[model samples]
Target: MRKADLLDELRAEIGAMSDKYSSELEKLYQFVCNSLFDNMADYQWVSIYLVEDFSFCLKFERGQTELPPVIPFGEGFMSLAAARGSVVRERIWNRTEVYVPFYHGHHLVGVLVVTGTAGGNIDDEDISLFCELASLFESKVKKCNS
Candidate 1:
């Protein structure tokens, strides 16, 4: 499916979903993971990390391999994303990866990381989609927290 179509479908699905804050956020995470994993064959891993005090805690993940439970606020690729409060894309051990930061109000929430599979590479479209997802998550989180 094209990026535009995928985003439109996601928006529609998210609108139809109704639940409590945490539950809805978890569902959103799962939806994002499954949707990206299924729609973008090149991507083999997708995760949502929640910020806790000064650390990035793994909230949800779906991929070919597992991820660590926690990472400091300023460490690794995820840290780079949080540090800049934007998207960071780089090649790590041959696979292309993109990390995006999520924010609620003026506070940093966490990060979203996506990695390519095998020799797969991430493109501009993937970055845009990830950014959009991050924005959506941030908006929902802010509303929930309020």
Candidate 2:
């Protein structure tokens, strides 16, 4: 499926499931990770890293391999995006990086990192959609926690 179509389906699913259960945030997190891998075939790594204390730690991941030890709040792509409150995309010969900020109101909560081979380089449209999904995920997490 095309990326737009994939995102549309995800938006629909998230909208439908957002308020249905007490564990909806966890379900949303799982859905985003699974949907991205299942629909975006180019992605080799997908994970959600939530802010804990002063660091961003991997809370959920999927695809070919596991992520590294930890992704701190102000390190690498996660830091760049989180600090700027925007999406960051990079294309390296063997690796591609995409980071989308997760926010709760005006506060940065975490980040979603999707990495893969160079062929998986995400474009502006993909980043925009990912940001939307990340917003929903952040909102649900905050709501559930509060």
CA lDDT of every candidate? 0.78, 0.75
| TM-score of candidate 2 relative to the true fold | 0.82
lDDT of 1 at 127: 83
Lowest-scoring 10 consecutive residues by lDDT in candidate 2?
Answer: 65-74
Off by over 4 Å in 2: 21-23, 65-67
Error of 1 at 96 (Å): 0.9
Candidate RMSDs in Å, in order, are 2.6, 2.4
lDDT of 2 by residue, 1-146 (tens): 77777778867876776666446666667667877777777788788888888888888778754456576655677889988888888776677788888888777777888887556556676777787878777767677778
- Superposition error at 109 for model 1 (Å): 0.8
Query: Highest lDDT: which candidate?
Result: 1
Clashing residue pairs, candidate 1?
none
Off by over 4 Å in 1: 1-23
Estimate, for each residue in 46-113, the C-alpha lDDT of model 1 and write its tens digit. Answer: 88888897988988887865558798776788887777788999887878888899888778887888
